[model samples]
Target: MPASTEQAVRVAVLADSDTRWKWGALTARRLVAAEPTGFVLRGRATPTARQLAETGVSTTPPREVTGAEFLREVRDAALRGEGYDVVVLALVGGTVRAVLQGLSELALERRPVIVTGYVGVVYEKLADGLLLRHGADVVLANSRHDAERFRAVYEGVGADASAVVEAALPFLGGAPYTPEAGRDTLVFAAQPSVPATRAERVYLLRRLIGHARQHPGREVLLKLRSKPGEHTTHLEELPYQRLVRDLAAPPNFRLVYGHMGEVLDRTDLLVTVSSTAALEALHRRVPTAVLTDLGVREVLGNHHFVGSGLLTSFERLDAGVRPEPDAEWLDRQGVAAGGDAYASAFDAARERVADLLAGPALPPVSPYYTADTAPGYLPGILARHRLDVDAPEARPGGLRRLVREAARGAYRHGVQRVAPAIRRLGEL
Candidate 1:
């Protein structure tokens, strides 16, 4: 396809440490910029600043900025006017509040801001979506249920969701559903995610192992959210090594990580304790089971899925009963961002943005922002990141990245051969 030379809609996403949120923003960017040169992209913030670098996904590093600087820069720039076509902010919480704070005093009416928020997981309207529906030009919701909720709370009316766009989540593989040649692989998407304790993590692992043992022919893949040890606010209380030693691990079962799109290509069955990843699998038409043996609402958060007709226990697994997904549950969950649904949703959002930019002049949100309507002070967006008014420096990618890649490969090889020996010595 030829690159578009039209008036490019420069989309800038206020990125932070959250990878999932970053992907959500990226999805919006990609969707809005259907044309090639119609997009100028930048991701601001550390932690996940270079999220897409060196991966199969994208090579461009998000322009880095401090959380503080991001808020200030976005505010000052928006005040000056005409730097970006649209600025994407976190939908649930993040820069939206601070950006709104900056815009509160200014009487700018034509400023374009889009909030990208996902809806697969359940969350309350604690901060009223950080006033996204009210302030932002549009709020992107991944599900119809979420779109309705975003509308109901912000506009204070149940008439319909207010200025909400029901677009298919972009990060989801968006691939067609094709049954595997044979059912040989079962993936357990592990997300001990903040709420789970050390003991609960071990229990989930044990369940996975027991299931793996039951089906000797199948290779059970334990797909982790993060690597064995990595820094994240959403901590998994326990390390896999400490728990693996106690169990009789099956030879076929092992830890694996890669592009989820590629992993799902080979997976026959997926098991999880409430994960957006499981929803991704179900969207792909893969046979998925939500484990509910522990009955710990805080840990797995799989309660909502119980009525989906996809929940199963060890007893049921042992009895050879496979649960099928109920259509109502699947529809409500917003499964499959592919086919005609995705195309229609994407087109709708694009049309809305086009209309907003090209239509009549709009009035400013407010000249004096009220505290009662406001959420709270922005933490990570302002104080942490060393944001500046200027654009982030362009990263050197050609020779430099190649050299770094070579060195990293050799270091990784050395660690793979020596890590086990080091682990054994540490055990003593």
Candidate 2:
């Protein structure tokens, strides 16, 4: 809690996507007794109205703003001497770096306790992501395995690792799994950019449809991350929705979207290539499998599950092979099987936060990559987000807002329309 007696602790969660928003908001609540105000970073993967509504996490609606606009808001708040007690940066590495730089520029008298972390399993850009997130008061690691890895990455580079705190995925909560009598629902959680290709996506979809064909009595769902023209954390260049249009699918199988936890409620079996949904399902003791039909490759991210005992092929699933999750692996990964452990996952984080809040004002946010350290690198990151040492101009409005929207619309058009057409032509 904050030093203020009149108001509760104020926490601001800034996120780039719907999934990140869920993680950020939930993590904010878990870390302290606070109701987080949400800010959606306007970008390609900006959460849609439907996606935001589906999360059902934040009580207040999120304010959508570009990177510059967000920085202005923070700077203004700091100038007013009314900054949030905590600000959770639920964004990508580059954006995190940019925000850190922007904050350092503010040099406020009372800076918020900055917190940042990964949304899920970090199969890619381990060093890049961890280092970019370095200057926060808390760099949360979602598992013991991640905590160790994060420390190693920082210590390897001689950077301070004190900020890396172990915590579980904040979104991991639901009713424990129980056997459903008839029409068991099998959901194949889909990622936007994993196995990033039309053929690979189609093959996975066909495999899912094949399973549905084999188990006619069972209900199968392709739990999509985003609908058409809507992006998630990753860009869906070749969506399953576009490919499924040509495929002849069975009535038992269909595409579904919305909250993953709700879907897992009736899920008899949950399958994925390497989605974080696997962790969510495992937390609830839901039958989960990391698909091996695509091969246990790092590119597909299933390599992260090698020792989890959850990796199996669609063939095995078709043959009724339900994997018993490795208990040790689950503990190491911080996916609690309910009870006291799961409840206490954020205890360390909470304590760390309390200590920070009670202590003297925090030093300026000093990211690892600075102009002094990485003159060639740091500028590019900040420039990408239009951030600088000086206070930003007023928030985007009138002509500026329209111009930004037009540019964003053009970029989205290139992604959702022009680029896919080019890919299809190239294939031909």
Each candidate: RMSD to true structure? 7.1, 3.0
List model 2 lDDT by residue over 331-397, tens digit each. Answer: 9999864459888989999999888887788888867787778898888888788864343233445
TM-score for all predictions?
0.75, 0.93
Which stretches of model 1 miss by more than 4 angstroms?
1-5, 34-56, 72-82, 91-95, 103-110, 124-134, 155-161, 181-183, 192-195, 296-299, 337-339, 360-369, 374-428
**How does residue 399 of candidate 1 score in lDDT?**
62
Q: In model 2, where do residues sit more than 4 Å from their true spots?
A: 1-7, 388-402, 406-428
Q: Poorest 10 consecutive residues of model 2 by lDDT? A: 388-397
For lDDT, the strongest prediction is: 2
**What do the candidate models score in CA lDDT, each in turn?**
0.57, 0.86
